[model samples]
Target chain A: MANLILLKEVGEAMNKAAIDAFPNECCGFFFGHEVGEDRVVQEVMPVENSKEGDQRRRFSIDPKAYMDAEKHALAMDMSLLGVYHSHPSHPAIPSEHDLKQAMPWFSYIILSVEKEAVKNTTSWQLDEARKFKNETLKQL
Target chain B: MAQVIIPTPLRKFTNSQARFEAAGNTVQDVLKALSTQHQGLKTHLLDENGELRSFVRVYLGDEDINFLQKGATPIEANSIISIIPAIAGGIV
Candidate 1:
């Protein structure tokens, strides 16, 4: 099982993404360094959602943005640890569609916003069976 | 009797029974038995097409059923099966 840590930086990043995606969905990638006791998220990239016109506001990362993220991750010796997305009116739970598309490795984070303010944040990890399990996040 | 371990989020559908005793020679049969006991659970696990829902996952102990035979995977009377669903949430 992979351990999860959400620093103040992560919380702030999530909030920012939520605010940015107000009328639509906001999406981003998380980059972090593996320190002794925690994975410190050092960078958050606010990217344009490729699926901008969908009513769901669900997004897929742009290929260009994805490539750039991969290059940056390799250079920084960081990993593409998690994905964060904003849910404008829904709760922060993976939908049936989300699970079907998720990779078995990366963590998935969801931020729920009500009236442009963040209501809740949660993170999950896909187990060996592709099922999601709750991950504990400690702020540093 | 086989043991079925239900994840927390799905417990409300199972009447709060974390684990259940079932009888079947295969995973599909066991799950069918479970759904019969708890109405609406099968719908949650399987979509209208009767295929496993994308977000729901099943494990035989530590091994995932997907890598094995899926619903056709054989089960021993004493084996433990677990059901888990993917969860997502954060700031809006």
Candidate 2:
């Protein structure tokens, strides 16, 4: 499995954001560079979940927010490697909706938030079959 | 001529080229030139009805074209157009 390298502090920050969002899902971006088959995360940028109605089960980054993040990544000289989102009260697994919405070439880091606490963290990527395969998450 | 910056995900359709210079007087023209140059990119940027996909956001300079004149937004010779795909998903 491919691995994604994240700084301990960066990982902690994602966890905190997940917990903070609580009953609702939290969405964000990860700015990083690719090292061979592995991705090294340098920053975690949280964005507003623009999905209207039932935010707890869904999350969508506003078009403006996505553009802003792209510019920010460009300014920082980093690639928008992937996205991170929390699944409130659900496991850190990519749901069917995720596979349908996801594009190739970006990693997805999912945080499992259970009762205002983080439970598990998992990373995923969409395969050629449009299914998500788990990626190893390494925090250092 | 306007420079359209293609996001990383869509670069594969452009032969992995990040940015390409296209000739047009408006956002629509430039996009038309882009799709004409890279035939594989047409569907990704536009749907069957030829409308920009909901997940695909096009910006004329720093402003989203949607807030401007949309596809009819005028462009300068050196204008920069950026294509950003929305990052979204859900637990369900």
Candidate 3:
């Protein structure tokens, strides 16, 4: 898998999570094996947004939730590939705030949820210079 | 004793030390020792009341200290601790 390969089932689950949390940002984790440059996603871990206020425009993954997700990934013998989140009423693009918080090497999947419908889903990666580079997404 | 791994964002306060060993029977003790070694780490890790900063997460292995014992989680010699900042953001 030279590009980001997301299993069809996983993609649908993420879309559902995005639509279900409409008007608020939904966040989750994806994990699977990494063979060369291809990241094969096999699992999806939806995390609750722990931000205290304004869930619509902001999403925060609690460390506890992260730890739990890591435990699950470990149990499945999979590595953490990246995080997925939805932007309510917005485009499937990384925002300035997202760029500031993102780390290199991890894939960031952004879903655009508008009017309670998932319109688009895109994946991105951060380069060495800390710039967001769109990743080629293969939904299979 | 325990080994605490520092993240890149907070490395400047720890002299770029990726990992360091500190003496402590509990996570609290280890963090206290670490703060003493690097004065700048205290504020980033703990609030004025000496509690863990809201945005700072201390993990013992794969378990969060907040779910276990907060700062009082007991640890063995090989206990690995990781400090991760809460990541949150959105365009206004």
Candidate 4:
């Protein structure tokens, strides 16, 4: 299992995204590098939704965000190590849909917020066959 | 024979089949058989260099193949493999 670390900035960013997308859903990607032993967040890419109504909260990464993330990672010599999205009213964990979409190598982070208050946050890594296995998150 | 569990996004490529029996002694061989049966799926699972794509994950039963032998991970007749893609989204 790979170790995961969420920097304080990541928490703050997630919180902001959660609040910004309240009553709906907010999604974004987390870019960072492996520093000696831990993954650190260097950038956050939040994209506008193309879907209509509450369906926007279901989750999807904008194609533009992928290009931007790739550019940023190349510049920093880091990788797109993880992705983060908020559960407006749900807990921070991988839903069944999340499991189906989880990539094996990237860390998946979920931020759970209620009424603008951060409730919980967690990260997951995909197993060989792409099942999400929970990973401990250390806040830096 | 090995069982390959298809994830939803990739089901279209597999003719909407969720699982299929593939013949192989190793993960690579099984994947090769799958790709041969479902054209274009190999591109989704492997990079141009034949390396597992960073975004695709393969699991043997409950264990990740990466922790085992990667594409070379041995597979028994009844082994089950799962393919998962990375998905992300939220309200904004």
The estimated TM-scores of all candidates read: 0.57, 0.89, 0.72, 0.60
Error of 4 at B69 (Å): 37
Check candidate 3 and list the clashing pairs. Answer: none
Q: How does candidate 1 score on lDDT?
A: 0.71
Cα lDDT of model 3 by residue, B1-92, tens digit? 68997754466688867688987789999988989899978867888998888767888997888899888899999999988766676544
Provide the overall lDDT of each model, using Cα atoms, as 2-decimal numbers: 0.71, 0.87, 0.83, 0.72
Model 2 lDDT tens row, B1-92:
78999887777789978789978878999898899899978877899988898778898887989999999999999999999887778888
| Model 1 agreement with the true structure over A1-140: per-residue lDDT tens digits | 44567778778977887877775667888888656645566678777767745625566665446545655766777766667787777788777666765655466777777665888877777775778887766656
Rank by TM-score, highest first.
2, 3, 4, 1
**In model 1, how large is the Cα lDDT of residue B82?**
75
* lDDT (10s digit) by residue, model 2, range A47-107: 8889899989999988778777777878888888888999998899998888777877789
Best prediction by lDDT = 2
DockQ of 3: 0.31
Query: Which numbered prediction scores highest in TM-score against the true structure?
Result: 2
Give the residue spans of candidate 4 off by over 4 A: B1-43, B46-92
Model 2 chain A: lowest-lDDT 10 consecutive positions: A62-71
The CAPRI class of candidate 4 is incorrect
Q: Model 4, range B1-92, lDDT digits (tens) per residue?
A: 89987654466578767688988889989888888899857767877887878767687886778789999999999998877554554432
User: For each candidate, what's the DockQ?
Assistant: 0.04, 0.65, 0.31, 0.17
